[model samples]
Target: MRKLALSDEILLKIEKPARYIGNEVNSVIKDKSKVDIRFVMCFPDVYEIGMSHLGIQILYDMFNRREDVWCERVYSPWIDLDKIMREEKLPLFALESQDPIKEFDFLGITIQYEMCYTNILQILDLSGMALKACERKEEDPIVIGGGPCTYNPEPLAEFFDLFYIGEGETVYDELLDTYKENRKAGGTKKDFLEKAAGIEGIYVPSLYTVTYKEDGTIDTFAPSSSHAPAVIKKQVVMDVTDTYYPESPVVPFIKATQDRVVLEIQRGCIRGCRFCQAGMIYRPTRERNVEKLKAYARNMLKSTGHEEISLSSLSSSDYSQLEELVTFLIEEFKEKGINISLPSLRIDAFSLDVMGKVQDIRKSSLTFAPEAGSQRMRNVINKGLTEEDIINGAGQAFEGGWSKVKLYFMLGLPTETKEDMKEIAVLADKVARRYYEIPKEQRNGKCQITASSSFFIPKPFTPFQWARMYTNEEYIARAAIVKHAFQDQLNRKSLKYNWHDAEVTVLEGVFARGDRRTGKVIEEAYRLGCLYDSWTETFDNDKWMQAFENTGIDIGFYNLRERSLDEKFPWDFIDTGVTKEFLIQEWKRAMNGEVTPNCRQRCSGCGVAKWKGGVCVESKN
Candidate 1:
């Protein structure tokens, strides 16, 4: 029997004891002596949040499948446990074996969001590892970062030894094999890194050097070693159908953020929304086979015995075989008292019908991410959604007995005007009015239209990459305009408006486009008790501000100022299949308030065609 890392006293004291304990259902256990590699995968957040992440689950299942590799899981301890661990001088440990993380070969962290930056430092500090990658010794585990955030890894570059550029399903096997080979050859850490650097999608931060121009822009980013490539190409799995998927995912002892079986219907998105980073980076859009999805759903549902199953995708409605798959799932599991969840679906006739069959119309609220309000604003963002689409969709949902409607929009979009901000309220009011269009007897209840706005943060690898961001004051002012507009609406009682924290948006903007200099701010902030900045209650803006002041790093320099089209970005060293030229064209189009067609409607020549798969090849077939 494996020993527990924490004592019963310590476990009982923590809020969620189940988070620290290992040996959950479906979790893999392996003999340490038998496995050549001991890999620890981390999500760098609290257990519930980490457990919900689909990427970690897929990678965990993939890694543990290798007989020679023993992959375990770890998450940043909660604040209570963090304090106790520090007070007791206890090292952080992985869940599976309750073994110290320092003993692992690789410490792979999935950086899903910018706010989790300080938590990365917390993990390293508690694990008795060097905070900076350069300061680490040979015996320390090699820390690698992956996920969407790695597209602009400059802000966290100094901490991470390396980054995996794209899909985990593609090049991980080759990376693991290379590591084994280097180990057998008795290669040093640096030697292994140099060898790994040659592989596609592998970025060795130490092997690369960056020189800034007089104006703080990246003048040159070149590889210092011959083994490292100048441009690290993003690895993609063209055939997603044959890729590794967890049939029996580890069931957490406690309820997770997404405490349900997740069936990923597809990878990437067809909608070319200008503000979206995922849409740009994950181009072409590949779909998993419906037959295979059916099989996985059955197995996952059977193994985990989860009450609900969610269809995971950037846009579930775009899946070619969605109707067939959803029908299969409903038929296969609906009788067994399983709830089917389909997110990211456009509200249409078929969608409403499908949703009506699966979801309780009265209890569940229908969500519409129009992303913009007015037609002109929608065109600027290439949202491919018009006012008619919103009204018609809302009308359909209302007719189908969905009284509660959740509308999502962005406050400070590029080229946004006061009228655009007011339009958000006007649009919500219009939806409420549409709800009342039905006769008094036909209506479910008073229509509830809840609209939310999040400040736009310019992310790397999108048309918005070169766009400027607003100050906290500016963002809040914009939200205030919308709130004021909501009060003046004819159907004011039915309309509710909510906006995201402007302060958090500003910080996220800085990190989104920030360069290597921002790393100091993160480390200093972590030292100043800035863990869990993503959580609204725990986020300390003053400490983060103090960190910036101490580091002499200017947030405005990273976010507020607009970049020249020719100005090289910090993330220019990596290629995400989508070319910068195409992004520039799209940026220009956005400025002209022109809408670009999606992958199905027309090819805008975004340069993802090189993969020769997904939506790019769907037309030919």
Candidate 2:
């Protein structure tokens, strides 16, 4: 049995003692002496948040299945425990074995969001590893990065020795095989990375050099060694149905952010929302076989004993066999007391019927992501949902007895106007009015509409990558426009409005479009005690601004300025299978308020089908 790193006394002081304990049911435990490779997979957040992520769970199960490999999990200590660990001089340890992370051969961090940047340094610092990749020697673990943020890894290049640029299902086995072979040959770290770079999707950042123009745009990005591939193509699994699934996952003793069993219905989204990065980067949407998904759902529920199961996808309603899948789960689990949670469904008759069967009227609220206010503005972002559609959906939902509704929108999108912002309030008021239009005797309750908006951040591989963002003050002011409009409604009590932190959104924009030099800003910010920056209480905008000043990199260069169509991007070297020409055409169409049909509706000639087959390959009527 692995010894507990925390003392009984110290464990009593923390908010959630279950987080540090490692004897969770279904967690893998292997003999360290037997395995040749000791891999530590870290999510740079607290235990609950990290445990909730599907990617980490998938990779954890995959890596541990190898006889030669022993993959373990770690997460950043919560601030309370962090202080105690620092004062007691406790090194960061993995959850399964409770062993120091510094002893591991490899440490892989998943970069899910830009806000978690500072937390990366926190993991390294507590583990006694060198925070900078260039400072590490052969004695240190090979630090690698992967996930959605790896799609544009330049901002974090200097901190990570290498980045897995694409889906992990295909290339990780090959990478591990190469690493094992190199170790057997007495190879050095340099030899390992150079060999890893030859893989289809692996990016060795130290082997490349980036040059900047006078205006801080990327002037050139080229290979510094002959071993590096000039272009790293993203790896995709053609058939997701055959990929490994974790029938038994680590069940936390305490409730996690997503406490229920999660069923990933598919990969990628068919809808081509202009500002969405996931839709573009994970193109040509592929789904798991319905029978396979149903079996996995049953196995997962049985192994973990979770009462609720959530269907996870970019858009759950867009799955081709959603109705069939949901009906199957309901029939299989309803008697067993297992509940279903659906996400991002359209307000259509089928959706209303399915939701009515699964959800209780008192406990659940219907979610709609119209993404914009008016039909014209919706077309500008290719949101595809018009005001009439939203109203009609609300009417159906109202008649179906769902009085509570949640609406999502993005502020500071390119070409947004005052009327566009006001329309958000107008839309919320309309939803409430639709509820009253129904007779009081027929209603579940009084109507409540929650309107929430986040500042738009233009990300790579999306149509809005060239779009300029609002300054922190400007974002806050724009959000105020919607809030004030909502206050004007006579039924103000029925509506509740909220917006994201403008300061955090501005910093996220800087990192989203930033190049290699942005690494310096991140390092400086970490040195000045910036950690857990995604948390509202821990984020320090003043310190981040100072880091920019210290590094002499203008913030406006990355975030506030609009780029020319012909300008080169820092992430141009990495191909996500979607062509630049396709994105450019979409950008032009968005400007003209022209809507492109979804993949199932019509093929738009996006280049992804050339690489692998999925939803984009079929002919449309």
Candidate 3:
């Protein structure tokens, strides 16, 4: 293990020092002598943001629970620190013990998003390891990745040695245990990965060869050897109640994305919103028992002393036992000054009742995403909620004494019209009227209504996989129509309007569904000062536009152009265990204005059944 030199200290002064320092109360530490396998969990971003993620924490806690495996944390250095490392010829090291990353048995990098692809390469270069798996020697660590972005890892295929397709809870241990057993007999990295490819949900890209046609489609993907599954099914944990998760997560010194205690009450969503990839990929919702969840919350509050506790999930309002859980937490922690916050609350009058239990006063504005303005448009997107739902939801909240409400909607969805844009303004006007109509005692004066709209980006493994996104010109025009509609009203000042840059949304669409060629564009964008595009202040559209030109790839091909069912998607090679037929069926239902029942009530029969062996909660009836 190399020590941090004098130069490293100087570099930390300019960059954020907290990202490099690795002492947290809940972090994993192990004796090097006793561990057979050492796993380095790497997040391809700065440490502050990465440490804030609950997914990384869960894996860290799960693996470290085993005495045979020791897990440590590693994050990519900021550009300023990278320069110093390059000048001083220093290798990237783990924060827990300053040990070089290459020394570990498993280097598990999380590919949360496509934007972090270059950072993975930079980490490899800094760690004194080969950037590509084929270039590495037998002694080099086995590089692997997991997370939401792993579903379409083709663009990043050149970098990662293997991709863990789905949930890490079951798959991670299988890989670790396999490595330990094989290494005892003195096998090489190739030998272990070859055997690992046999395990479910593990994709060893090197063992299979991908050939592209001259027309820019996949000609064929043939397995070079007998070490692969024809279709790798993603691992699913049927019961989340028994899952191992940390009750008290590490509380950060500086406020991170989630600034309070979070309890993951559920794993998946039952609502089949056509454009939602999360709902499609993370099929078959699993809930934690109310009693177990309440106990966990009490333990976390006692250990970390966090003032606010959040009931986290795809949709907290949809949880069957949410009322009971909230009652228990409020009863137990109200005296302790703990406030409950729900992230994805459905907009309804009943929601207001649940929210009232947590916040003493609704000081902050309430937020709800109607997704589309018109009933017809909402049906096309399969939002499963009508305009009446929004009207009732807002009316309820205002009556409950909420002065302000923030409404979220998307522009440029499939089959959307300018009339749909106008309807947004009409809906806002109606909500404002409803707000003022509340009697004087219950009413809060000067009702604030904020409507934020964004261009919809079609994602993979969803019903919109073949759908085309809006071009820049189209988005701007639609946005203007929606903005003016609100202004056209005589009392428009009562309503506020905000929208994101359409160009950024388009670029996100490109990277979300792009192929290996997309990597060049990312590299060029980073080379031209596009770091932290995730943040609003630093995103440069011109740099990204120029990068696309330099790479000779048309952005429209990925974002604006619609694909046919016959056309090969860049992510076709990887299997997420959900069938194409299921997604296509949902797409048909979206067009017919039909709503699929929630997974808890009826099985939509999305193809997780291939691996689940039985129907998802929806289909049994």
Which of the two candidates, 2 or 3, achieves a greater lDDT against the reference?
2
Each candidate: RMSD: 1.1, 1.4, 2.4
TM-score of each: 0.99, 0.98, 0.94
Give the alpha carbon lDDT tens digit for every residue of 1-621 in model 1: 889999999998999999999899999999999999999999999999999999999999999999999999999999999999999999999999999999999999999999999999999999999999999989999899999999999999999999999999988999999999998999999999999998999999999889998988888899999999999888888788999999999999999999999998888888889899999898768899998998998899999989999999999999999999988888888889999999999999999999999988888999999888888899999999889999999999998899999999998899999998889999999999999999889899778899999999889999989999988888888988999999999999998999899999999999999889899999999988999999998999999999999999998898889999999888998888788999999999999999888888877788887543434654343
Write model 2 residue lDDT over 22-102, tens digit each, in one string. 889989999999999999999999999999998999999999999999999999999899989999999999989999998
Each model's lDDT comes to 0.92, 0.90, 0.80
Clashes of each: 0, 0, 3
lDDT of 2: 0.90
Per-residue C-alpha lDDT of model 3 across residues 314-390, encoded as one tens digit per residue = 88887889888888887888887878887898966667877877765458678888888888888887777877788
Candidate 1 structure lDDT: 0.92
Instruction: Pick the TM-score winner.
Output: 1
Model 1, which residues run further than 4 Å from truth? 611-615, 618-621
Residue 451 CA displacement from its true place in model 3, Å: 1.3
